[model samples]
Target: MGLSSRPRCQLAEQYGPVFTVHLGGQKTVVLTGYQAVREALVGTGQRLADRPPIPIFQLIQGGRGIFFSSGPRWRAARQHAVRTLHGLGVGRAPVADKVLQELRCLVGQLDQFGGRPFPLALLGWAPANITFTLLFGRRFDYQDPLFRSLLGLIDDVMVLLGTPGLQLFNLYPRLGALLRLHRPVLRKIEEVRAILRALLEARPAPAPGGGPVHSYADALRQHGQGGDPDGLFSEENVVACVLDMVMAGTETTAATLQWAVLLMGRHPGVQDRVQEELDRVLGPGRPPRPEDQQALPYTNAVLHEVHRSITLLPHAPRCTAGSTRLGGYLLPEGTPVLPLLSSVLLDKTQWETPGQFNPGHFLDADGRFVQREAFLPFSAGRRVCPGARLAQTELFLLFAGLLQSFRLQPPPGLGPAGLRTVPAPAFTMRPPAQVLCAVPRPRGR
Candidate 1:
């Protein structure tokens, strides 16, 4: 289970910084505490960079994408993913425009609830569609059946990724495959791939005049057609990479937004402070922009705190590229290393209040928003999340836009206490099912 690692870190404090934990009969080295995690993942990143093979992910299109593959294959796929996104304006005004556009539609949809309780289940849809637009040159309507199904499948896949069956499959790949325990997961993967294939097929050939590289699929196709002797970016790899973009990008960002809403509702005082900052920084009728992040210090702090409070993935699995020493221990080549990121997020020495939801962790004495080195919600090192900037932008725009436009509150009859947040175990730590009321704020308040 991907629960808090503080207890394990406490054990580490007693035993040692680096200790071995038994997982599915495999001895995995666990690095706890900020100094240990940072030293191994950041200091000797490349040495500890290779991804440990998981049977489930290895079955993900034969492990062709950036997230699963290692060595030259991973390098080429990652380079393509990064370069393609950068070419598509991932960290710039173009991507922000896409996010803002979707956010506007999302706000409008929430307005129809009329301050009534609404499930934030499909909160990931807009961002998923934003990613869809980036990958396939199209966006799905909020109520599109296909779009909803895709999101549902993605959510199910995340749930499956953390199951005991998956763990057993990871440990004994052949036996799990023989038992067909991975069949359900494989079916879902096929469904996701089918969607990607449809979108790829829908793409028209590049114009004879060759104006501009349109979408991610097109960019990938153009690259593949350029005749690579290495065959790094093959057609199958293109689909897998698209799947990676959608899978890697969607739930994490969506879960962050969901946590933001829940936290805002749970702590109305903090929410108000953020709204106050939003109003003071950018007044009525204007949606908050990425540039506004600097001016809106309290809001920025709250966003950072939300990520800190709800550290998503408890740990990231890393493998030693070669024999190397980490945390004062000699790890042999191909040794599996689990960097306890949750420990770092809630490290006692680094954070003033490691257990509480305090935005002050990222706030300076003068109320300026300051970045904390311990904020490793995205994890770090050579294999750090490739979509960090895009995720941050989505988080900022969605968080700021919603707070600016509405006063988020718990469902009627459910106070903060009634709205208890239990962690839903998945590929990430998902928030419990709760309803939030987006009470539209009066204009010019």
Candidate 2:
């Protein structure tokens, strides 16, 4: 089945442009058409600003983090995070430099594989490392015990969220609690929270007369002082916010990178074109810079294509703040609403040849790169992904740098490129396990 044939997108397309799905006793209105999504997410504003209450998130984060929380707590935390990211130069040169350094390290690691089919598991490490640097003012060795533990925790949480049992629990929380079946999941949450608490506590204190610390932790500390002076920036909030950053920043970016390599292996001609652009713009001896992106239209287009093909996180779950009209239907306040992003992204109305992996979707008649309003990978409106800018910077740098240094291919004996991606659903969608051979290119090739 094609990617769009997945149950979620299929349901969205079949149920008119906007309709409600009854899950347990709750009603979730899902928006499929572009106009409907805009109306629900942007036009109504705060009416659709709240998030659906996920029991797992509540048990794990205590509903204190920016992603799940609402009202004053969410506003303060989200504002602080955005401001802190700006202060750390997230979309500027300093952050780009950091991303480029990690990309270089990643290229070196892939080069070590000597064109053999190496697992892409290692590919996840670099982006996750970059996130750690931004959040804690430090990076970890690939084999660091703490880093490995954090990755494991992330994986477990994602699996739990995706499991059918969890969905059933979300639908019937009282029964789940009565049978004592959720105890294990609760225990896992506590364990992860404890580790996060320790890490936040152990973070180094700012030095005397420090002008501004560049880490996410420093931002939290600064915000704690004035913004939430009454203890709203408590240790729990700090831990939850930091964990949210690490999980959101790392997992989604890494998964996209993994998909890019897989797609390149399946379509060598496209891969070659990307490499050609990298060579012409970056040359062989030096690494690619963020500014060089303007000169490499095809490479940029390919990255956008990968994002479109792999619609990360089928939809963004939201809730209505009050009774509002969307798609001519009355949606009551607190009603869950899912803006089906994949539908809008792959809608034939918006994209030409929506089913194919064509980079031209992002290009103009003259081959110049162009932006599409329907590109909602980060979703739209006030509740959009906070790491959107940061993730875009990382994706471009890492993808271009890798293609610049090596050519990815399948092992000779391996069968036809298996584009089959395992659907590991979570707060974000993830790719299944896969590997590819990364063959290093000769200098000045």
Which candidate gets the maximum TM-score versus the true structure?
1
lDDT per model vs. reference: 0.83, 0.79
Over 195-278, each residue of candidate 2 has an lDDT whose tens digit, in order, gives 777877778765534457869987786666654565568777888898788778878998888888888888889988898778
Measured on C-alpha atoms, candidate 1 has an lDDT of 0.83
RMSD of 1: 1.9
Model 1 agreement with the true structure over 157-271: per-residue lDDT tens digits:
9989878777778887788889888998889989988887987898897554335786888887887777678777788888888898888788888888898889899999998
lDDT of predicted model 2: 0.79
Q: Candidate 2, which segments miss by more than 4 Å at Cα? A: 1-5, 8-14, 179-181, 207-210, 227-230, 425-427
At residue 416, what lDDT does model 1 achieve? 78
Instruction: State residue 280's C-alpha deviation in candidate 2, in Å.
Output: 1.3
